[model samples]
Target: MSTQIITAKWIVTGTSRDGDIQMLDDAAIAFDDGVILAVGPRAQVITAYPDAKVTPHPLHLIMPGLINAHHHVGLTPLQLGAPDSPLELWFAARLAIRKVDPYLDTLYSAFEMISSGVTTVQHIQGWAMGDLEAVVGSASSVMDAYADIGMRASYSYGVREQNRFVYEDDAAFCDRLPPETAKKMAAHLHRLTMPFNDFLTLFDRLTDTKTSPRARVQLAPANLHWMSDDGLLALQEKSVAAGVPMHMHLLETAYQKEYAARRTGTTAVRHLEKLGLLGPHMTLGHGVWMTEEDIEICAGTGTCICHNCSSNLRLRSGTLPLMPLLDRGMTVGMGIDEAGINDDRDMLQELRMVLNLHRVPGMDPAEVPSAGDVLRMATEHGARTTPFGPRIGRLDPGCRMDAVVLDYDSATYPYQDTDIAPMVALIHRAKSKDVHSVLIEGDVVYHDGRFTRVDRDAVLARIAEALAKPRDADELNRHALREAVFPTVRAFYDGYLQTTADRDPFYKGSSRH
Candidate 1:
């Protein structure tokens, strides 16, 4: 590979020194053979490598490419004209959408992510259509799309053995449905269900055959409510044997808290501890309802949590106790989680939102999220949760050459101070349109409003053609079944909560949990 130097007006190295973001003003970065060679003063770099080709961005800010710690393929629910609902009901509505080709669906979101400065995404798959062969094929399509687009991705299929929908015996809920609706629901479940062991086997097979430097396959148990004890234990064992990272959604709602209390006689975090599932390798998604004790356990176990701030607010899952989580020294990362405040995969804007959302009415300067903290969470902390190895997110020497360049000349100047830190100003004001270029593995995948590897317009057109028929027979059937079963599912939870309201601490919301 040819050696190259990129001189930028500012380079936010995405590393901290003495609790501050390390910045190099008027610096140049050199890369060769998909690895960073140097990052320092432009004059020194020029003197050091006189023969290297130079690409100068006199009015730009270069930084490590953002990592979206949690994401899913396909269109956003808001785009489908579906309003936000609680996660339990939202799952049913989300399943009512038409299925498109996995490759196109993955590309559709990748385009959004790359354009918005996201270089790596943890793409969690929940689709289990047809047999094992078909499922594996769909997963391969996702991997192929990311590979072709030159985006780094970590992939996992969401798996559960029981309680596919509500937090109870799905069969018992089916018994309340009319025979026809019950049969339709059962068929739908069968279409989307695979044995838990088969999921583990599929993970092994995918990793063995579809290996790539940019793509990783890992284990994910959907959530605490969805998986049985045996299935969770089996997943833990498999994850340990494979030595890959695990991701799961935990306590994203009050309903989940109630369910955990009733089923395990404790909180979800404690239950996972009892199952021996909380550890450095496991990353819990959302974590919106963790109590003080739960936080203590997570902190003790060295578990990481990916905070999806906009997703929680949009779905009314309540705000994650981010300040508390940070205070407890638990590792935290940022994820768009299928949608952000703008209902798109815009990581820069997502960083801004995270900074603004966690401010707790205090006069102390340290009470709110600093720009460096939020940016690190999006870059470094997010990368730590993926299977991308150690040197993935930072922009230092020997790290993978993944970066984003924003045009500081356009909407990013005048007030950007050299004496004072520029991260705070950039985080609050930067927009996705300001992204001028994106590179992964020393390759310029997106530059000057175009993707180097794929035809963006062509893939988008194909996606539109693929999803032209909005509602298929299967989706229509699932909708009818959801309509019949969701009421009972809602009522069961309401009654359970009502009966246990006085006894259960989870029912009381303002308890600093």
Candidate 2:
């Protein structure tokens, strides 16, 4: 295999020991055939491999590419008129948006991720629509987009067997609504129903493929409240039988915690354990409401958590007890759910947000997550939630050569600090514009403000044109129905909460409190 050596002014190898990242100055890395061959001081590597082609960067910081552990369809709910409301009502707003081609939608987000130094993503496909063939085609479109862009992705469509909306049955919810409004709601929501056999069959067909190094298919049972006991078990069975990872949303909202108590008379985590669904192969997304007992269960079972800091905050969901989770040595990954504070899919900014969000009001230095911890969460630990795991997170020998090059001129040039840690500086200052290039498997897919593989401008223009079209009759009706159901859904949660005197012990109300 032909060899290439890339030398940078600073290389932050995301290999942690004890509690610090292993970093090198004036470092050079050699790779061949998409695998890292060696990483060390510049002079030694250059001297050892004199014949390897050398690419020198005198002002760059090289680090592992970021990983998005929990993601969904690229289109942000907020952009689609879903305001900053409770997640339950937010769901209604999302249902009101116009439909776009899945391929274009996936590619649109991939472009943002690639430009912002993200090399991998876990796309939790929520619910597949249309007939069986159409459903499979939609999934294929998403996977094909990832392959075309050369970004590694773990894709799974979440299955919901019951409770599509509200905590009760569909007929009951419809019965409560006015006849005309009920008609619209049922017509829109009823199509979500699909046989369990059909769901698994589609997943099986999508996963049965000649595996690409860039993509893998997994299984997801939408959420703890959305699935029946039988549905969860069937998902567990299928995940085990197919030998793929399982990722599900667990306790994302306070209402969900209530649902767990009301339905199963216990915490959702314990309920999953009872159903034999908690295991090393499972990853729980947005575990913002997990209690101490739930944490213990997760720690014991080796189930992982993906920290989507931006999503939790945006949806007004409580923050995950990140420090405690890290202290227990539970694996946690970072993600920018739908959008970040800037309403964009920028991982670099998300990294900074993750660092700041968890630093509670305490003088204990240990309470704050350091830059290394944040980096690992965005890279190696994040990999655990997907099929990639340790293979693509580090820059050590034998690992896949997935990395990002930051122009130090843009990140830390005018007043370079030799005393401050590289990652600390990066967390505070780095932005997507600082990304010089992003590489996956040693191929430079994004370089110097341009994507090497696809016509970015054309793709973006097509997305704009598609979204700009007038809403169809169904889309228009969805908007009307969402408004009609929004208040009822809010009332449902209010009444449900009144049934119990339990208050969220973890989340202190916002400053307004």
Candidate 3:
């Protein structure tokens, strides 16, 4: 590709040495062949690359693209007929979800993500109802969607060696059901089963055959309850040997904490530590139920965490100790897991939620998240959790030219304050509609309310057409099974926590009830 210069009224480059966001006024970024060439004042950049074609966005603010550090599905569970419930029970309710074409389903979310300034996503795919080959096909479709849309994705097929539904073995849990119900559940488990070795094979195959330069394969150990000791060790070993990071779900709910304690006689983080999996290569998702000691262990080991703020609230999982995690100097990333609070993948909205949610009643300014901190979490810190690393997160020399240009006028319309920083104003006021352009690898994938590569309206129409067809026999059977198992799944978690203290809220509310 030929050289091009994109000049904006303001440019917020990556963070500085002191952990503050680096902003430049009337700045320009010159890039060629998907790599950033220079980023500085417009005059300086123009002088450096004098012959480059320029595209000026005088009314826009350009910044590093946001990263969704944790993501699962495209059409969310809510869209797939699964209502919000507690995390444990939500798994059972999710069984009723009708299967959609993976490619179309993935594109459905990719459109939402790119429009909302999310250029890279950590897609933790799981729950494919077939053997190893079918799972691989599903994964390929997911990755293909990202590649076709010109977006970056770090994909991992979540490894679930045990505990597919609740925090119990499949056979053991099935045995607890009625005779007929047990038979169907057993057959369902059998269809989803794959040899442990096949997981490694899947990882190796994906790593070797990645179709897009913008896509990379990583490892996910699903969750603590979902993994056996041997499975966790094997994944850890594979992670180290492959030199790719592993993202695992840990301590998302109170019951998960109890399950970990019951299983290992220790916290989940401690168990991972014992297995030599606590390191920079591992990222724990949610971490809402992590103790102070757990936070310290993660901090000491440089393990990352992805705070799925919206998912926690929607699933009633509990609010994360974000302030404590920040105070400990932990590298935390932001994610719109499943969907944001608005039932869509809007990173800007999620950023504001994270920024305001942790503000305690006290008037301590240092305790709450700053605009810079939230920006870092969405950009630099989020990039650290993915296999894409530093390449796609920031607009700097040698980094890929992935960025979002927001219409400053639109974001700060009808009123204004010159005293407030641009990043602060955008975080608090900007919506996905204010996103004017999104560039990935120097290609303008989305610009002026249109995608360059794909016809979004046509794609959505195709999806609607596909879902309009009658549910197949398998789909109908799964729906019936989900209804039958829902009550039993709910009953299994009755008094699951050992003590009243465990059931009490982790967050101390400001109200004097």
Candidate 4:
């Protein structure tokens, strides 16, 4: 195996313990194949491995690559014409916009995500492709796209099969279809949990064959409110059977909480518990409305929660009690949640947002959430939210050789020995442009601003053209998508009659849903 060494001014490895934690000035790392063979002071490593290729990262800060614990990479196109109002209003708009594929959406989102120092993403794709088989097939094709780009992805073919709005499932609109379309779709979705299924299967296989292990694979149950009782139960069963972590949006808003409570006569978390779904295998997203009891349940079940700071803030969903969650001993990861909200895909900035959002009046920023806490959320804590944990987060010898080097000239540069140096420059000053290089599973995928494997510009142009293609929605769909879909969706929520006083203790006079 060939060896390479990267020397930097500071190596602020996101670590807690002093020994394994690396912060070497004038340090050099020796790498063979795709793994970090050794790390120490520059002269020590270089003198020890005379034959190793030496590359100076040149006045840059070396750190672990960023992980986006939550994503719907191709779903950004769904936001194009989404409604003007909050939550439900936007859901209607999102539903209309989803029909447009353009294929470019996935490439565009991926490029943006990679450029921002995010080497890994937990991906969920396509709500409209309800038939299980079609979902698996389409997702397989998308995985092919990711492999070419050298992304370490935890991908799942999202299966949210519910018989609801016409826009949600439009098999009837297909003018011509194979007689076995229904059977095909069902078989495909079911096989999603079967061995080597959908996107996850392809990713897992690639890593296993790894002449060197290359990528990460994770399974997601999509989100709660989107799935039916049976579907949710199946996801839990399937996830446990596969020994993979389950991802889902737990409680993002009052509407979801109330809706689930009414249907199940209990909170969503409790309902899952009754179904024997609560366990270490589950990783939930959001949890904005989780009751104290729910938080306790999460702690007991050993479930990790990924907080998508930008999406929640973008949709005006209230800020989460991060300090409280930390106090409760629940692991938390950070996420961007596609569509470039928080405005961009920069995880460092998102981490900074996590810090600032949790630190408010009277609450001392130091006490509420330190920079170290946010940094951990982006790495170790973030990894827990996916199937691959400790293996990828740290810079230990055996950990995946995935890390990012931040340029010292960036706005967040000149990190001092203070507690905030790592967090401030990381969260505040750093942007994708400041990223000097990125390595995932022992390979450099992003060198400077260019992706090493994929042609970013060509992929982007194709995406722009395809995104523009989906807006027209054809015939019964095209006309209905533009004019009737939003109102119909809005009508479903608006027409929902409330029979009882909201059980929520924090219920306000007005309903945001």
Candidate 5:
């Protein structure tokens, strides 16, 4: 295929050798057959590739596409009637959410993500209910949605072997409830249960039958409390054998920390390290309550972390010690989780939130995140946590040509001081509406407020029509069970952490206090 060159007023190529943001002014990128061939000054590129067809965006800033390193579900929980609550109680409340068609639901978020310059997402499918075949079918729909929309996705079926509800055995927890509620809970758990081997089969099936090059399946251990020790070890082995990475949720809340102590008499990180599950291939999601020692373990093991700032705040999970993680030179990716603070999946807004949220007390400039650091989290660092890895993160030679073009004029409308750096200005001023175009695999999938593949409005309308129907008997029953057992679920964690001194306060009071 002939080379295509895209020129922009400014280009953020990637990070430099010194770990700073790399930028090229009046630059152009030349690609052929979906791989970058060269990125340099516009005049140099034009002279070198004189015959290449050039597309010029003199007022745009082209940058590597943003990656949502951690994501789950399509419709926000609030839209599905699950109000923000503590992480433990939120699971119960989510059981009542109205069912949505997996394809349309996935598309709903894909549209939002693409509009905000997110080109890839690490979609961890969790809480899937039904037999193996049915679960596989739902997973297929999710993958198909991304393929149809021309967005890359790293998908994983969460391997949850135990503790489907509370951080206890399913049978044991059900036995403690009222007889009727016990029966209902047992039935509900039964639907979600599949043999451990079936999870392996599901992984093999997805691995062997991937429909699109844009989609790759990985493994997720779900959470520390959600999996047994044996299951986690087996998963680690499977991940190594298959050459795929694993994203596991760990220590998102103080209660989870307490649960880990109660279960293993140690921190979750130490327990995982003992089981040989901590490594570069492993990404721990929401390390909100990680202790200093836990951080050290992760840092030593080269384990990645996906920081879900909005989810942590929304679920009342404590803020992650992001500054310390960065200080340790650990790789951290950005994730919006179920939804961002505005109940939408907007990566740009999420980046801004992450940039400002960790500004702790005292005036240590080194403690605060710079625009380059936040961008790295959303782009290259986020990419590390996914199966796509380095291939799709940077706009460098040998990397996949996945990028976003922002209308610099629109982003800094009225006037922007010339002295202000482009990267800093875009981070603070850019909105989703300023996204001018998006390219994936050298193809323009979105441009000038339109998607090249699939009808977003039509898909959204179908979703609205599907959910407009009245609740069915099965739906009503689930809602009733959720209501009947919410208090019980909440009570399960009452004082659960009160007795544990292992818990660390998110903030320490001043000496005067």
Candidate 6:
């Protein structure tokens, strides 16, 4: 637990009222015992921690580790061939061709995320009914990736009853299902829900893993909208009983809101509130179509909203009122959503997009979020959406030594003002290559384009092998019905695909969704 010095030309703390966005020069961060011990002038810190190790990262920016509030990490490889279909159709088709190996995808995704200085990701993992042993048989490689690469992560598997014929088919779209298929799916879920060994084993095994001082685990209830009323309520209760956070997709789009309202005689968010599922322990993804009242209710209940900005833009799911949400006292953070559709898991890109997306429609863009706001979303706010909220995010004293050093020489070039330096440089230009090094819990997981403790090529190869395999009959059935229903999904969404593929600027380029 010896101390260390991380001196940088620019120190962007992203904390409230932390002077200008950037330090004048030679800013130093000192940490020991897996926690930051001081933050001030380089000369002062050097004098104090003289016996501690000194790793000067000058000509770069040192800041808190980036957090991804929502991302489906294990799908990194299979995202290559994802059809640009509507929401439900796209998900169904994608599921059919999912890579059988969750470990590889998780590894590759973690490596990519780490290279970009994403020290933590709240990753969503989907598994089929019968793939218990395969889906997440051992979270070792993934947890290993985090430990060795010095990143933190959250993982979840679920009891998602995706009735294939539920969307579109030959008059078989009702709740009724044939005996065999239904029975098999049910039995698979039974086993999947009960296997706590892999998660438990990984957590226990990786207690001494490389660089993971802030790592943690939690139960994720995939989607409340997709689950049955009984199932959804049961998951909420279970999460509450286990003292874990309940994460799910809620009011993601107009269609979802419409469907839920039709079924429960109320809006989706309202329905959850009435069911007692909305609370401090709940974190909902998307929240794109939430009404003002719904927003107020969430704030009052202390619920966290994960705004998946990139995914919503790509899926044509409409825009979220981020300003209003923040103004109303809601604890909001950003998520990368599912991998692939505008799908670069780079949280820096997510922050850049968030800043530009809010510009005035036809006025000067000077009023948009200053770079400080964007940085906060990725660092401070992102951490608030998970279990490590208190201990990570900021670089203040007593926080974990999880940090990233950005090379101002490459992706960042020619700094103008020393005052607004970090904001102007980072928000405008932050490439994955700009990351010089990443540290998790005072251990260097990545440095100068390579991981310190893992075989990068082997991980990529394993993910490729898993995705190269084919889907069996049951998985194929799920894919076919969902893809076939693409033509009937609220027509406008069909037009959305045509417009995107055609790159048509006119809103009416296609006549559907």
Listed per model in order, the count of residue pairs whose N, CA or C atoms clash below 3 Å is 0, 0, 0, 10, 0, 6
Q: List the candidate numbers ranked by lDDT, top first.
A: 5, 3, 2, 1, 6, 4
Tell me each candidate's TM-score.
0.94, 0.96, 0.98, 0.83, 0.98, 0.82
Error of 1 at 150 (Å): 0.4
* Residue range 464-489, candidate 3, lDDT tens digits: 99889898898899899998888889
Q: For model 5, where is the 10-residue window of minimal lDDT? A: 501-510
lDDT by residue for model 2 over 1-513, one digit each (tens)?
Answer: 689999999888885744488789999999998899999999999998999999988888899888988888776767766777778877766777778788888988898898999999999876556667777888888898899889989988888877788877788888888899989888767677778888899788887762567888889899877888998899899888888888898888888888888898888999999999998799998898888889989999999998989888988887898887888888888888778777778998888888988777768888888888888999888888898778888888888899999987798768868698776787788888899999899999999999998888999899889889898887787888888887788777776764334655653435774
Flag regions of model 5 displaced more than 4 Å. 17-19, 502-513
C-alpha-based local distance difference test score of model 2: 0.85
Runs in model 3 deviating more than 4 A are 17-19, 499-506
Which residue pairs come into collision in candidate 2?
none
Tell me which of candidates 4 and 6 scores higher on TM-score. Answer: 4
lDDT of 4 by residue, 1-513 (tens): 588888888776566731124466777777776677787888898998998888897678788778898887554533555533556566545544544342455566667777777877887664534334565455655666667777777776555444223223333312122455434333333432333234344434533543313444555665565566776676666676667777787778666676777678888888877877777677788878787788888888887888888788777665666776777667888888855454557676787788777765564554477767777788888887776777777666766778888886674544444555543555677777888888877788888788888888887676566656534423235334445435544655663435323454422334579
Worst 10 residues of 6 by lDDT: 498-507
Q: Worst lDDT window (10 residues) for model 1? A: 499-508
Tell me the deviation in Å of residue 479 in model 6: 6.1
Error of 5 at 391 (Å): 1.0
lDDT of 1 by residue, 438-466 (tens): 99998999998899999999999987886
Which predicted model would earn the best lDDT?
A: 5
Whole-model lDDT values for every prediction: 0.84, 0.85, 0.91, 0.66, 0.91, 0.67
lDDT of 6 by residue, 260-368 (tens): 6656776778888888888878888888877778888899998988888878877777677776666565667777776524456777777788877766454543344
**TM-score quality measure for candidate 3:** 0.98
